[model samples]
Target chain A: MTEQETIGFFKCLADKSRLAILKSLMEEDMYVERLAERLGITSATVSFHLKKLEEAGAVTSRKDQYYTMYSINKPLFGVRIIDILGEKTSESEAQKEREKAYREKVIASFFEYGRLKSIPTQRKKERIVLEEIAKAFQAGREYTEREVNIIIADYHDDFCTIRRDMISEGIMTRERSIYRKAERNGGDPEPAGR
Target chain B: MKNRIEEFENYMRSSAEEKKQKIAEMVRDGRADEARAVRAGLNMYEVMTALFGAALKKTGEGEEGFSREFHILKDNVTGNWKRNLEAAEKHGDAEKVMIEESKLETVEEIVRKFDSLF
Candidate 1:
């Protein structure tokens, strides 16, 4: 059985009525009337719980002498529990797969639903970006106004602030809203010379 | 603006993995301190997971809001650890689970069933 079916089984087992039924059934199989009496629940309620447990692969009912006997479904239990609990020697090893599909939703709301959120500062290692943006300025090739904004914005959400920092760090200079390296070197010229 | 949750979770998992390996090596080499540290890590994982659960609003019976799907995985893994170490104690593997059983209450009891490991 799949995880949902397994989960369904546990959820079925979660109920008071079903648990009372299982605790009763652990001794021996019994008729529906006996179950209702032992559980002190109504016969209809007992039957209802039985059906759910059976659906959960927790129990099985079989017609007997003038009454149906309800007992723990060891075969199904072995299949589901052992797979998760990793038990071998289970009887249902070669049986057909029980495809129990529920609406399996993976609700990963990544805080990116409606607005453009900045990647948080905790994830930012400024040293790495400082080095990367420093490379954005090339030999005597100053960046235009928009280029500086884009470069700073790439590594940080607060571009204006980071731009100020870069200026303070002597990495770049701004004039007439454009930016350039404070002084471009032959600047460790690219080895491939491209 | 630090994503404390993600960092905390990753740090917890890798930290647990390291402890697990350390204990296994201890088992091989008969180093008892390694086993003790491993037990501590498992207990820490359990307590942190419970803290996460406590932060969430109770939505239904045992259904927690503000919790992630990874909680289930963590639950199963810790359950497996308890089961294994309990069996280990049964067979004279170590006293790690016993030490943890006294110090932590992270493993919530199964409904209607009560035990230290539960």
Candidate 2:
């Protein structure tokens, strides 16, 4: 199943009434009123849950005479949870876009004319600012402590705090008095000289 | 047996048709008020705002306390609303299923009432 289908399937199972209906259906294919009677819920409530189950692909129904008979969808029940949760789809792309936009927003909020206004208290926001400052240093080249201070000071007056934050956030690495930008691949910072 | 996903898609498509047919029958039979009430009940913003307002009032928070409470409430209610809206939009064209203007106006009126409290 796709992400949306997986979510729908899990959401369908989350409700007590729906679970009861499914349990009843598992025993025998029954009509809505019969299921409602067995579960001791109102027929209307049973119908509501059945519709949700149908939408989630958890239940199937067929028209028999004047009544619609409902039954458990065994194949859907057999679908592994790992398969449902592990499937990648467009939703993942959409989520990535949202994260990118949020990162941009945080960077925009904290930076003014390529300078950070203040260190963000939130770790996530601070990481974005530190990464932006990290761009001033070359990935493979080392800088003296003084050079690091000058580069970070250009962005914010509190160079020591910014430099320390960079090191703490893993955006940059410091060894002795030397500093270098950490190599980042897919947002994971790799320690320098390692 | 039908493919589960395809079965669901078909079921939703047919359900929408059935709803439209029900509404058409209601109109033809001169029960527009009942239909309108049902439609209004289905309006997410109206339903959410009403529930939020009730919960807010239940807190008994005065103006001094309302802002902090409102922020907490807004996060949860808006998050759920956006998720529901996104899911609905994904399944069908949102524009086609858009709520009527008068109903929206009513929702706005309800929100304005809450705004007055803060």
Number of the top lDDT candidate = 2
Off by over 4 Å in 1: A1-132, A184-194, B1-44, B47-118
The per-model DockQ list reads 0.02, 0.03
Taken over the whole model, the C-alpha lDDT of each candidate is 0.55, 0.65
Kindly provide the TM-score of model 2 when superposed on the true structure, using C-alpha atoms: 0.32
The positional error of residue A68 in candidate 1, measured at the CA in angstroms, is 64
Clashing pairs in 2: none
Runs in model 2 lying further than 4 Å from the true structure: A1-89, A185-194, B1-118
lDDT of 2: 0.65
Candidate 1 per-residue lDDT, tens place, A1-85, comes to: 5545667787777655677788888899988899989867545446656767887889888999899999998676555544675
Q: Number of the top candidate by DockQ?
A: 2
Candidate 2 lDDT over residue span A1-194, tens digit each: 65545766887687666777888888989997898778775454466667778978999989999999998999989878777667667877768766866887887688754668799999888887777777667778889989999988888899999888888878888888888778781244431111
The C-alpha RMSD in Å for every predicted model, in order, reads 23.6, 20.0
